[model samples]
Target: MALRVTFVLPVFPRAPVGGFRVVYEHANRLTALGCQVTVVHERWREGWSRPLRHLREAARDHRHRRAPHRAIDWLPVDPRVRLLIVPALTPAHLPSGDVVVATHWKTATLLPYLTPAHGSPVHLVQGYETWNVPDPAPVHQALRLPFPKITVSTHLTRVLSDLGVHSGQITTVPNGLDRTTYRPPPTGAPRAGVAFLLSDSAAKDSRTALAALHQVRAHHPALLARAFGVAPRPRDLPPWIHYAQGLTGEDLAAQVYRPSAVFLCSSTTEGWGFPAAEAMACGTAVVSTRNGGVEDFCHHNQNALLVEVGNPTAMANAIRRLLDDEPLRTRLSTAGLATTATMDWQQSTAALLTALKAIS
Candidate 1:
């Protein structure tokens, strides 16, 4: 019998995000493997307590449910995979399946309420998730649930252990690189510019990235920098740093990843660093903070330069070093490419299936 897997997301993403992208990738691959896959987007959660805000969001979700295809036009989802936008995470809105997976801490809280018909419940821990909520007590509580946990990094496994999840109950399934979309160009060109992802989230630490760029610009006055994200460019952003909003797939590779000399990651934390891996796959050297997300594939002065998180001066120094030494940059880029080449969606998805089977 084919496995029936259903994923519950906290909400439909209004824009492209790493967490959502990972789910979509797994859904596509699993469908190819003959698994029955369905992704449920909880339109209205308890977090939006205000009546006006709740009504507004519910109305938007109704529009998406009416035309589900347009809701995720930004992502490449398999048409065979079912997409559902529900009013809430109630059992009444969910379909029974072989196994139901929770993609967020909030979604995990609802798993216990689901009957056996909803299938075995499992929590997919992409990050520590303490940063996502104002009060982390609930996040910790969610981690402590008896449900089996699937995490993306060693750091996250350790975190779950601290929260009292048994080591045997936790599985690590790292995110994979899409080689077809992110790879080196036919020929290398002069790529003097630096690139990084921009986000409104404070945890992404875009301020630290900007500060590091400022320090680099002090030495190389005409240094070129590019940042891309779903958010519009902030008004205070310096004109020298070009911002490209919502670039993905081939366009992202051609515009931001391929032409960059170095990719910068200033995030304080992550379950997995998707952008860094994609950039490395494109043969661009990387200078990133010691964020847990990148530790899986990045090495200090090997595949990429790793610095302490939240330090603009140290990140700036590493970026400067990569900029000054062409040979070292090429060496790191070559090594980075080799490192990411082994991380493929096929391997990660197989691991995920194994984890789900164990819980099921």
Candidate 2:
């Protein structure tokens, strides 16, 4: 009989973020590997969204939050895959399988109960979401579920151990990207300006990126910066950098990645560093700090321009290097694409499958 796998992320079936995207990739890819897979999640936040501002829209229409048409049910899933979408109030209902993978901290806590085996549930940790955030209801509350103990990074694995989880119980398995779908933007596209992405997600430390932007524009007065995700308020930073809120898929590719000179990451911490990987794959030289998994995918001189964490001056200098040295940027961009080939979704997916099998 084919091995059965259940990948549970209680928060999913929602919008596309790093974790959501990773879960979907695994769902499809695991099926290709001949494992029967079931994905259980709640696609929308619904009535539970504590943020009043966000609630009105999710309540007005399920489609009001993000790409409303981009619901999980409508996607073409693999024949061997089953997807379950539940509302917020409903408890995750399931039993043990050959393998149970939990993507979030809360989901991991629930995994032991979701399935029969409490001792060996896989925790797909991403970063210091625990260290940086205030209310770690999902992660800490889930850690109570007996972390299946697998992580997405060494830092995360260590974090779990520090939190009283057994070191041997947590395995590090980083997230991988599909370099094939992510292609370099054509050189022919008219360059509108330099592009930067921002999300308030605490781990993103977008404020650090903003701080660097202040120094960048000051030194190079002609430099123009454009952005995405929720625009920072007046208190966030200076007015020189442009912000466009959020973008995704092809629109993100054309509008944000195409004409951008270099991709920037000023994160204070990370688990897998999703934006850094995507930027490199799109052939944009990345100027980022050596935060988290950037070390795994980026080679300081070879693939990216990495700065010391928390140093805006170094960050600005790195960006200035990309702006001034075309050859260097091209070299980093070209090398970055080559680096991504080795660390594609295939690599991380293979490790995840192996970990599942090991526990099984």
Candidate 3:
């Protein structure tokens, strides 16, 4: 008999975010492996007056009017996978399945109410998401729910351990790279520029990255800079830096990583930093802060140049070092490519399936 698995998601963004992408990939791969996979999306609701709530929903809908309706539009989702859209997340809104997975802390908080109809839930801890919630006590309490936990990086595992989850209850499944899409360019001579991701979120620290880029430009005026993000282009961005909005994965690989001399990541924390790994897979050297997740694959002075968080001067120095020393850049790029070569979706998905089977 095929295993019936359902994943509960808080909201589906039009643009591809790292955490959502992981959930989509697992659903698609599990469907291909003959599991009955279903994705349930719950729209976020505000605890305001009905009139105000409707207005907020209308604004959100208008903002994403150009976005696609289904995951298949942007990602490679199997047709066999079923999608369920619900207005709100409640016990009555969910479907009973052999296994239920909560993709975020908000959903995890509701698992206790769900266990009677469904089964012991599986909490997929992608990051330390307490920072995003208004009342983190609920998120912390959810972490202690009697359920199996699967995390994406060593950093997340450590976080769960700190939250009092035993080592036996948590499983570590690292994120994988799509080798087909993110591989080295045909010829390895990249243009004289650097690339980084832009975001409005505080943790992404886009301002620090911009500051570091400004410092790099002071010394190397000829150098170019580019940024890609799902957010609207900020008016404060220097005219010299090229900005691209809502780029697809293929476009990002071709336009940003493949052509850039180096990729920069200034995130303060991550469950697993996908941009750095993807850039390295495209054979670009990376200069990133010690964002927890990147530590899994990024070895300082080997596969990447690591610096402390919020230090723009150190980030600028690392970027300058790579730009000036071609030999060092080549070594890091070569090593980075090798590091990601072994990380494939197939392997990671198989590991996930094994963990699921053990618990189920």
Candidate 4:
């Protein structure tokens, strides 16, 4: 018999952000594997005026069609995967299943109130999300809960262990890349330039990336700079920097990673830095700070160059070294390709299923 798996999500299904993408991929792949999967999402927020909210949702849907980055475009269509939209996440509103997953801290806190009739609760710890919220104590307490845990990286595994979770209670499943979509371009060498992600989040630290690029430009006056993100292009970005907003997965591979010589990441933290791995898979060398979770694959002076976070000068120096030394760049690029080759999504998904089966 197939296991009935349900994921309790805090937000309405939308564009695949780093965290949400993982949830979407798991739900989609599990359905393909013949599991009966259900994704439960909130349909409306409490205290919102229904008429006004409807109008706003209509406008947002129109905008999403024009630029999908504004919202989610890829949702599972398999008949085995069902979407249940409810008013809220109270115990009465959740559905019963063979296995139920709490995808975020808020949901994890509710697990104790639920019984096995709601299925066994599994905490999918994507990251140390307390950093983004105003009150972290609740999230911290949730970490110590007795639920079985699955972390996306070793950094998170360590974080949970530090929180006093027993090693036997947690499993680490690293993220994977779609090699067919991210492979190196078929032709000439990558163009001389640097590519990075742009975002408004404080943790992303896009300003530091800009500062680093500015420092590099002082030496290589004509060095190319490119950036892409889900958000619309910012007004303050330098005019010479090529910026593309709302690029799809295929567009990101073709327009940004495939042609860039180096991928620069300056994030203060990450569950798993997907862009860095994707760029590396496309044969672009990576220069990044010691962002958490990226440590899973980024080996300094091996597959990529690492620097201290929040230091523009160090980031600039690393970018320049890569630009000046063709041999070093080539070595890192080759090693990065090899690293990604081993990280197949099929393998990663199989590991996740194995864990879920044990729970069932």
Candidate 1: residue 228 Cα off by (Å) = 0.7
lDDT of 3 by residue, 270-312 (tens): 8899999999999999999998999999999989999999999
Backbone clashes in model 3, listed as residue pairs: none
Better of 1 and 4 by TM-score: 1
Candidate 1 whole-model C-alpha lDDT, 0 to 1: 0.90
Residue 317, candidate 2: C-alpha displacement in angstroms: 2.1
Q: Candidate 2, residues 21-124: lDDT per residue as tens digits?
A: 77777778888888888776654564454678457544534452243224554234565567665554123454346777777665655554543542245667
Best by lDDT: 1
Write down the lDDT of every candidate, Cα atoms only.
0.90, 0.69, 0.86, 0.84
- lDDT ranking, high to low: 1, 3, 4, 2
Q: How close is candidate 2 to the true structure, as a TM-score?
A: 0.80
Every model's TM-score: 0.96, 0.80, 0.93, 0.92
Which candidate number has the best TM-score? 1
lDDT of 4: 0.84
How many collisions per candidate? 0, 6, 0, 2
For every candidate structure, what is the RMSD over all alpha carbons to the true structure, in angstroms? 1.7, 4.2, 2.6, 3.2
Lowest-scoring 10 consecutive residues by lDDT in candidate 3?
63-72
